[model samples]
Target: MVQKRKYAALFIGSALIVQGLTACSASNPNPNSTGTPVATGTAGDKAQTSTSGEKVTLRVMDWADSEKPFREKFIKDFEAKYPNIKIEYTLMSVDQFQNTITTAIKSGDAPDLYPIPGNMSLSMAVKGEWYQPLDPYIDDAFKNQFAEGAFVEGSTMLNGKIYSIPAMASVPSTLVFYNKQLFRDAGLDPENPPKTYTEFRQAAKKITEAGKGKAYGIIEGGKQIGRWKLAAMDWSALGGSGLNQQSPISLVTHDANYDGKEVLDVMNVFKGLKDDGSFHPKTMSISAPEARALFGEGQAGFILQGEWSIGVWKRDNPNLDFGVMAPPVPDAGQKGFLPRSSYSPWIGMSKTTKHPKEAALYLKEYFNKDYQSVLVKAGDRFSILKEVNESSSEIPQFKQYYDIAQKYSRLVPNPQIRNPELASVYGNYKDVQPGVGDILQGVVAGAIKEPNTALKQFSDIVDKSLDTAIAKAKSEGAKVDKNDFIFSNWSSDKNYSQQDYKSIQ
Candidate 1:
């Protein structure tokens, strides 16, 4: 996935010698009456000291929007503060960021900071000693700025140290966004949206019947490799916790009903939607961008999107009338659980970095409230601070999403990195596909044998995969227990009487 750099430049370094004076051939003799030249320090010393009159350049990399004007504005203000430091930003695509960052790390030329996705690979990040720990730099003052559970204990936390800081945290699971116009055209009430799964299905069905070839009730992304997205979404929306205290461990090697019922129940809903022809046929191959585009163009009615899609949708279709709401739960009595979705994008220092203090100063100052507010306005990312999120005035489009995120977000502890051997036991998107495809194809094809068997096989594969990964991690000296993967505890404003805040694991 490495894109070739079209332009390249090379520089050769060597010791510098003062040339003889030309023109007037004038030379100043030492005041001590000894003809001697000044001493020159080592190359390392030269690098350590910034030129007195020149600026020190700090390089930054990100996969998010590079052209967003807010970033440029932030840099201008940052430069004004540190007149001697120049910030250079490089942007890359998320798909290619890993390879790109790896290359930079190898050359010891990566930017001062960049975001890393929150999947299984992050586990390796800590294990491989690629990141610099922030414990020394982080005091109550620094930690207080971020919200609680913004950093998962064992997952993002490694070896009793916090190595990364999630840039813009979001509710990763439990919310679904729908189109207003489509709902209206289908004779469904736009203002009071669905609050239960039954209502959701009914609303989707109405849209399909009214739309004909124009629209679909819902779009299923799980049919393709995007099933992970579906799993995450359902895990939260359905209020299914991951491995945790109250929930305890569900041994994949021995238990039959550990993780199956919840996963299957979520899958069956989509299978029903697919069978009903409520989903677009093109969903299997559609990427996230494609889904966004389809929603923007008003081709779909209800979409399972989050705050991340808000900014893009507004930009793409400013005229479109849209509304945001929590993904409907099973009943009004049961408040919906919004799964914390994406891995909190982290800003980690290089373990091999020689300028730890300087880097900390940059992060502490640069990512402080002022600039972070700029990021919140420009991007759809939620702030990591409670004060900032609660007091937000700008970005009206994202207000609802931010509010729900602050209140109902939860997470699962299952790691999501890629490992070769475990891929067979757990299966990848390819394994998830046939089962989901069978459900979809069966719904459209009027066959149950394939979808049911495929789903059971798929679940077995996932269970086995988890078992393999756990064993592998143990062999590698990881201090992992079954409880580590469970999410028995949960916190919410409605669940508890305390007015401060609550967390659901």
Candidate 2:
């Protein structure tokens, strides 16, 4: 079974407390714009105190579970070097991790550092007003070493301040992990994976017929609510760039923008799969691990997963014979809509930190070559540094995915969570639906009809959600600079396909 990581927060706590002025600056009229505090005091700050001392303890939490042998060893190695830093490790489910940290912050016991998503990073940076600014430490040498998107320098920058740094950077594109044995049984060439949507569907059909009673051609996830594999992966494969990446400010929250005839066609293909009964009924609720296990045991032909799957599979079954391929495109020569999956839980030090210099030193070490290489080797994670990719020992199967990412990958910009106030304008009708995945599952199962309408409704809500979020941010002192947020290079012209459900029916 696959092991999942949860929320990881970094906290350095000391018994000593230093009080100071807590007031919004005159330069900004917004009630929330408090100049990031410059912390004073060296004795209790995490940066100043060595963890080797019996009295000093440095609290570090990571979402990476025990299954990640590499991270475990890395932590042990770091602790061995910094004997004074008595690091405490805590494991929490992904669902509970964020809430746990938020509650700790409320109780004044938050960790000194923690991992945060892109949306969370922006939100906390603007709302918390606690992380220390590392500008003083970001010298020319440091700046020159990092890549263009390493810090997400453009997206996470707020009011001329940067709050977090990504340990690795890459846009995540979906990957197809198939059992070589199963492919051969189905009369397909395991070495030559499908290149287009038509070929993919044809392969799935043959695999299903070959599996007989014991296996399936494909098993899509159907649990949760409206957002399922059919919508996320299948639609993306059919060339649906629902959300434009050209603009840093415009996030895909609404269906009207990207949910025309093309999306419906994507849904139709998925519906056809359900009609053929090639998927498992429990696909929605059984979890990703279950799906992986099924494929590993030769009960399923193909599974769609992120980059980590390769590392995970190697850990579980060292001898499993499988091949990794890019998800199929709609055409033979054209590129598919590959969603950027390069994600790293980011680290940000609260501006309220007393030992800013010390924290920067740690950050520099964190992003150093030696440490990153170890993580990549053990964690099966891709690094942000271009040099790392050029020199990585990743297997050829995984390397192929990396090579493809250079040209076809796209990031989801201005995610909905980053700016909640603009929810309505951006088409966000409700808080992110935990059960959304299940809704998509229902469509795949024939339990729900009009899949396009359902998807559109969800999309519409997200679109308005962003519109409202941006307006509120502007009203609340956020600078509305169009050039910075807009993606002027993106084109939605002839290459895109349009669908009409009524005409098809």
Candidate 3:
């Protein structure tokens, strides 16, 4: 299947770095965290419900290492309050979680809470009855705590049914994580990293040459090939490829463009880096965690990843100097910007869960102001709340990220959001084998000599899959069309607004 990055996978290392809440003042842009956990949400719970009975264990599965420590602490605090409910949590790789969760759903044994598969659309999740309606459990008081547009049809709500809740703010998953020391050693300026595609390529080759087997130019978690797919999507967007930042489908032409020059050019650079011996020798087998660790060890000059690594490297390898920058773009300059989709829930209640009230209760508190404040205090993620985001602005690293995202991440047109009925378009869409990620992997590994031909073939197959999906949705008496994918008013830099959706009608 054509794969993409999961909503929460990008922030795995955003965990452990935080020591405690820092004493902040308006003057301190980079407020330092201290030595005690004091988020008021956990250690200072105001509403404690002591239920005395047999402890109810809720099964929860996730893929975010970033949320692990906080999740454990939250459970501990929650258990102290309830005293009758326990959380049984499972953390796994994105691939493993999706595979196991899918099997569990098919066997009528799904976990109490699980993330929707990266490959599944909201419509598909709804059609398969993967999540139970949460509306019954959500009180207006708890609901009002969320940001505006937290629930929408074809997203958190489907067909008037609330299926999920917001977990994190929308942020692009791709950014350049580079070693400052490596740049110095390679005779490159640490202050000015590569900005254009050619410069990026040359810099990698130069760094690899200087390393002389001690390090490499770049590293990737090649085992999880979606890493490359995400890099391609984000970097290629600057080329004005028209391909959606999240998928192979184009936002402009409403056609599959996996073979388009934008993506293929990015793929070629990835392949060239491999050919130049700029990739770490173990890049093909290492996981992202392993790669990040290697990068911390100064074994790689650069790693294409998210902003959260700033926290990880600072804590783990304090001596390793590094910097963050946007992925290198085409020499001609950036022609497009990244598209920011709305907040997507990383976890939702399973339809078969027995502890509906308890699970719903936890869901409501998951993104409350208290927890959000803690998240910002720890520099984990940008919260959906304006006030929490304002607090995060005091942290220098997060402030830097805010500037990058501001320039790159703009809301784009989405057909599913415009017309809820069009959700079937994604539900019925079939993903072909050796998808975007695998194709890039094959070319890099020398398994595919003709990368261009492979990409074109994949594009054709995916395009055909779209046609088949449209036909299937139509056959079921849903008004669907290929043309629905296009928003004529939207541009590469468009900030799609609510009014934009209304105007189409």
Q: Who wins the lDDT comparison? A: 3
Pick by TM-score: which candidate is best? 3
- Candidate 1 TM-score to native: 0.66
Q: Quote the lDDT for 201 in model 3.
A: 89
What is candidate 1's CA lDDT for residue 477? 58
Model 2 bad stretches (over 4 Å): 1-55, 65-67, 96-99, 107-109, 117-121, 129-144, 152-154, 220-258, 331-336, 339-345, 350-365, 410-438, 445-447, 481-488, 492-505
For each candidate in the order shown, give its overall lDDT on alpha carbons: 0.47, 0.46, 0.66
Poorest 10 consecutive residues of model 2 by lDDT? Answer: 16-25
Per model, how many backbone clashes are there? Answer: 18, 80, 0
Per-prediction TM-score, please? 0.66, 0.72, 0.90
Candidate 1: tens digits of C-alpha lDDT, residues 210-243 = 9988888876443322223333323433444231
lDDT of 1 at 239: 44
Residue 7 lDDT in candidate 3: 45
Tens digits of per-residue lDDT, candidate 2, 8-121, equal: 111100100000000000010111211111222222233434423443344544343323454444446555554455445564432345567667666777666654421243
Worst 10 residues of 3 by lDDT: 16-25
Model 3 per-residue lDDT tens digits across residues 23-94? 000010112451222233331243455222556887888665554555666677667666677778887766
